[model samples]
Target: MEHHAPTTEFLGMTFNLSNVLMITIASAIVFILAVVTTRSLAMRPTGLQNFIEWVMDFVKGLIGSTMDWKTGGRFLFLGMTILMYIFVSNMLGLPFAIAIDSELWWKSPTADPTITLTLATMVVVLTHYYGIKMKGAKEYGRGFVSPLKFLFPFKIIEEFSNTLTLGLRLYGNIYAGEILLGLLAGLGGAGIAGALGAFLPMLVWQGFSIFVGTIQAFIFTMLTMVYIAHKVADDH
Candidate 1:
């Protein structure tokens, strides 16, 4: 049987209860992790602090590769926050998905196209905002037609294409992973013989899902910085 996400109407708009719940949980986990990792300032880091510092360094490198540190320094926190939130969100559905009375109450938030597309839209909007802010409105507008006026249409189309690719790529990977995981779980639950048969495949697929989740998060964050760099950096 196909399970549907519970829904609620708020402010005359329908919302998916499962998406909302999982998003909140993922955000809270990321927030708590940030707090716990940075609560104590130390000259010499250890344990969680060390791990977070390394992650921060990695984010910094990602930003640096796209643009100079001078231009990308301000985005470090944003990049780190985005990377952590998406990674946490991706992992939430891996442990287990919950459904009550045929209504799903728990799953990965990014598995929903609405959530992924919203994120992509936000990133694209931020890029435009930062572009205009950094380059001035006139200069930023000129970028669409730079090198040749004929390229304007292509440039306009690129924005839409970028948004769709960024969002849909993430949704496809996560949704498919969750679906396969659920199937494996069902197979395992059938009987002792089925359980034994499904056990190894389930374990292997679960591990692979974690890897896909991590890669998806990294790709999204990296592309975000790349888009911002194109706007903010002077050399296109």
Candidate 2:
């Protein structure tokens, strides 16, 4: 693979540098945008502020759709953070990328398993934490065996499955899209014939990829809320 995650050692451990950089950059961009957008309040929003306020309302609606506002409102920050970060990270790779040897300096952070899995783990952990907080430990534990004790093992397995699927789903889609874009770029590098061949296809896929990225981010956000609802709902 031309685009491989760069590794570096730290404190007797190793980490993927490319993934780390992308994550950090994406986070900083989102943070800066948030601050800039809301720096001042106006009677009528304009430009960045208008767009950001719209995003907040859209995200809040998504949260409300999944669970009651009383319970889901607590995760508004988490939901918003994940949605904005993922969307921005996904778009980051749509431009140019630089990859040398086993080091990639540009790409979507979610394209790396480490980043996506860590995110999925955080969401899962929070769901369990909120579950225990909302309902007693005993009650939350009993949820695994709800309706029937025989289902306890399956319920336990579901937790692991959810974690795997949640991360892999985003990683798979974004990584595949990036791979295709990379191949298209390679083709265009050949000559005039190559450019002609790749042009229309590249244009089509680029537009579709953006749509795919947006949908994947939304799906991930929705699933986060759903997982939380399943764990923390009173009926659970």
Candidate 3:
């Protein structure tokens, strides 16, 4: 029997329903967790406060190590929020003990180029905003002409390339992972013979995909911090 693909439409735009739902659910979970974690502040930390504090410290350390405390503290919230959102979204698609057929969603939001590109665009725009805010319009404009005014085109190209790389790197990794899983599932659908052919490879790929997902999240977060730091740093 041949299977027809499913399509979802919203606002006249078509998207894979599974991908849309998974991203929506993940975003909701992140928002709820953020609300719950920050609703109460304790003088002596416990429970959610302790967990929140630990995550803050971890992000603080990452920025502090890469940059000065003053700059790091300034962008700490942005960095932490990006890291948490991506990390949770990446892990949301992990396979569980439930039967594979029962699983409705099989890909993470970061796997979608549209979602990742939107995030990358936001980061790039924020970098420009902070750059202008910190350096003033004159100095910020001078950055394009720095070292040699003739290099302005190259600088502009570099900025565009940074945003492209930030988005594509994440989308490529997660999309490839999803493709590999789909291939494995196709093989597994062929019954006992296919299960034998697919199981070991599926196991290895799943494990490696999880690893890649985690590393991609870290890379995205780190690049975001690096971009902000470059923008806000005193030394250009």
Each candidate: how many clashes? 0, 0, 0
lDDT string for model 1 (9-66, tens) is 9999999988888899999999999999988869998888998999999999999999
- Model 2 gets an lDDT of 0.89
Give the C-alpha miss distance for residue 90 in model 1, angstroms. Answer: 0.6
Better TM-score candidate (2, 3) = 2
Candidate 2: stretches off by over 4 Å: none
**Candidate No. with top lDDT:** 1
lDDT of 1: 0.93
At residue 140, candidate 2 shows an lDDT of 95
Give me the displacement of residue 103 in model 1, in angstroms: 0.7
Off by over 4 Å in 3: 1-19, 36-49, 96-106
- Candidate 3 CA-lDDT value: 0.80
Q: Superposing all C-alpha atoms, what RMSD in Å does each candidate have to the true structure? A: 0.8, 1.4, 3.6
CA lDDT scores, all candidates in order: 0.93, 0.89, 0.80
Ranking by TM-score: 1, 2, 3
